[model samples]
Target: MNGTSFDGLTVVTVLYRSAGMLAETLPTWVRSAGDLPVRFVFADNWPADGCADVVAAHLPADRYAHLPDDGNPGFAAGCNRAVETVGTSHVLLLNPDVWLPDDALARICAAAAEDPDTPIAVGLAMHGGEYVGIDLNPVSLFIDRPAAVARAPLGPSGGAAVLPTALYRRFGGFCEHLFAWGEDADLAFRLYAAGLRTRGLDLVLPHAGGHSVDGDDRLQGFRAFLLARNRLLVAARTFTWPLLLVAVPVLALAHVALAARRVRQGLLRPFLRGVGRGLVEGPGARRQWTGRRFGFGSLLRYLTVRRA
Candidate 1:
């Protein structure tokens, strides 16, 4: 790890039947990273469509590597696997659906150089004109939302986030068991507990929003279950017992609010099943993230205001 090197950055993006979008966005991403010594890594979650071809067509052979993983291992797993191939001091997790600003990614790397303690630097996300920033509120990311970190003090945009590769690995990357939705929360909460702040940069990233799973019939209602399941899993994995006691009621209400949306989508069954799965699986996951907690009492004070 080139701990002090601002010149190196690894842009990790996990692909899921995203070749078309990858092709569309690749040029801008490359241009935005101009002369920045960025290692572009694409982890293919759905390889049948040849995301490799898109990368090969757009980038020089030495600039990128393709990690083929099938079985649709889920976003959390893909992100973790992709991060493994990183050689840079800082890692930026880019989603295929997002259209990066020509300067945003580079500026984020520069910010990393300026403020080494933040570890994580996030670009604000705008999905269809909405400003969604990094929300550290464990409960905030769980609810289907588009709120900003400043506004909500709660929701996070996992897609356009940048962090040092060391802290990411030290906290144990994304919780692979989360498989999808709340993994970002799982990691964010853990980092917050470890006394790290995720700074939101002053850049707006445009998102094409849910390109992979939005219309996929196979994953219908799957995100809902994962969101619900990971909500509890995150609580166990990152919350101190005291935090859990105070958080349970707030988290339960958040679940109920999300449940109403799932019900409307006719996903009540899977949603409920996920809650049960979370209860069954949380304790095992707890062992992986418990050592990082500083104190929930301090965390409560830090919850609403994380210095940007």
Candidate 2:
């Protein structure tokens, strides 16, 4: 709210057993938050990592606050929960593993505030100590490297994006149904549907991927499920019912094609099973498959909420 300048910006982050990283990240913010009001809020979904004490010990009383809850709620819920407590003009939903240089967070806030009509601004996510730029189609985030960053249309990155709390609330935060994987796409779709703009900023923030979710457990399969479910939800809400009907065949064939490819690689069983589960359980099932949930309801609202 510093009139497009870096003044009072609050940082919100959701933690699911990622406290160790917080110890390293919070100090960086504390040292560089400047005169700006930056709240390093931590929402402990389960507190399995003793995050409360970890954050409390490092984060100053005036600068950080811990949300009261436990439940290991999914990332979307955790982010929404964090947004509720933010009273600042801007909110940056950050990840614990994200290592911000002293002034990077402040700069992103400043960049976002430059336009009063700014709805959302995203920063580049760096991994393995390099800078990663953003692109929308097929979604890309550049990593590692000290160089110039560029702003462009990008598929949303949940980490380190600055957004006005008003727009965020109006959009109803993230669709809780997504749980994880597709929430970014779902949110991006809503922002686009509602006639708002989202910009990707040229700045690098380090991200340690999979530090929280174990890779060997076939977490990607769960990601695939959410992606499949939410992608259908987006199509159902955004397209006319008839158009959605037509699109289904195309999408189904694509799924089959992908499944066939995966099968050839000996990885189709879980992917196919997840896809089947996604079809039976999401808003898509009622609308595209039967038009049940679509009967006498706003398509957008109806599709936005629901277990998928």
Candidate 3:
């Protein structure tokens, strides 16, 4: 807990084709961000085998920087281009295979500066040592919790988290046509329909999960066609045409019974061409939906919330 306790935090990390896992987790994420005064931005999704000169040869030049290349149509548009070239007011969306520990960015910037409505803090997401199962079910867009479920009301886990930078550019920072998977549950369903409340933090980070296509089989079938067309463009932009016409035919028959159980695990033709390109681009990704009006008691409290 140093560097004036992450004054004006800005940890951001996007780097596609992560050069050998950012040369072994960016120096253990700059020694677990111990001396905090954070500012690490790295958004280099233009990876043609030169991940921004390997993060400017393993980070240094004044607490790391990197931007320029850009053009990588994924990871939420390279985290909205490293939060629009950083000038931090709290950002931390880390990933280069995750590592942080020293105090995990001064306990996630002291829980988003002791929360005065700057909520979104979730961390924990470990990997082989347990703690992963993220589950959110606004009528079942994502759900899989078995490891004796007990984390508490916290859902979306975009690698790691933390927010604010003007509420991530006023909630317009992650839907870049969801070039990657469900785009962090469509940015946590537009930050819970703008009332915003994501705070689950025991502050840990060990991820290493999917180290930039680890053992890639054609980017794992284009990451299952961008997670089956961004889960029907995040359920037609977070439901509500009468819950998206009763949850899009039961989510297209549960994605055709999970593409017939991924065709007996052989992952049937990239899961039926990612469910036929997510039903032909889930209606133009519903114009990148944010019609924010999640009622029905916030969909039964986002399907019985409980991620403490």
Top candidate, metric lDDT: 1
List the candidate 1 regions with Cα displacement exceeding 4 Å. Answer: 1-3, 136-156, 304-308
Q: For candidate 1, write residues 1-308 as lDDT tens digits.
A: 33455547888998997999988888889889788878899889889998898899878999998998888788888888888878888788888987877987678777887865455545544545554444444444343233443433232456877777777787778888888777876776666665565555666666787888777655777876777788788888877788777777887787788788878888888889888898898789788765765356646566555454
Cα lDDT of model 2 by residue, 1-308, tens digit:
32433345678888876777778776776766766667777778868678888877766788877885677678888889888888777788777887778878667666765764464444444443443322222111111222233333323457666777776776678767667765665565555544454555666666776667655456655655555555556555544456557666777777776677667756676666666666666564334322122221333442343211
**Who is ahead in lDDT, 1 or 3?**
1
| Alpha carbon lDDT of each predicted model | 0.73, 0.61, 0.68
Report how far residue 125 has shifted in candidate 1, in Å.
Answer: 3.9
The residue pairs in collision within model 1 are 135-154, 135-155, 135-156
Window of ten residues with lowest summed lDDT in model 2: 136-145
In terms of TM-score, how similar is model 3 to the real structure? 0.34
State which candidate, 2 or 3, has the greater lDDT.
3
lDDT of 2 at 38: 72
List, residue by residue over 1-308, the lDDT tens digit for candidate 3.
Answer: 11222247887888777877788777777776767678788877756767677667766788777775656767888888788877767787877887766766776777777772454545445454534334555434764333345544333466666776776776777887777767777767666765666656665566767777768788877787677777877777766577778777887777777777667766678867776776787777776664685445566675677655
Report how far off residue 230 is in candidate 2 (Å).
2.8
What lDDT does candidate 2 reach at residue 186? 56
Evaluated at residue 279, the lDDT of candidate 2 is 69
Residue 47, model 1: lDDT of: 93
Write down the TM-score of every candidate. 0.89, 0.76, 0.34
Better of 1 and 2 by TM-score: 1
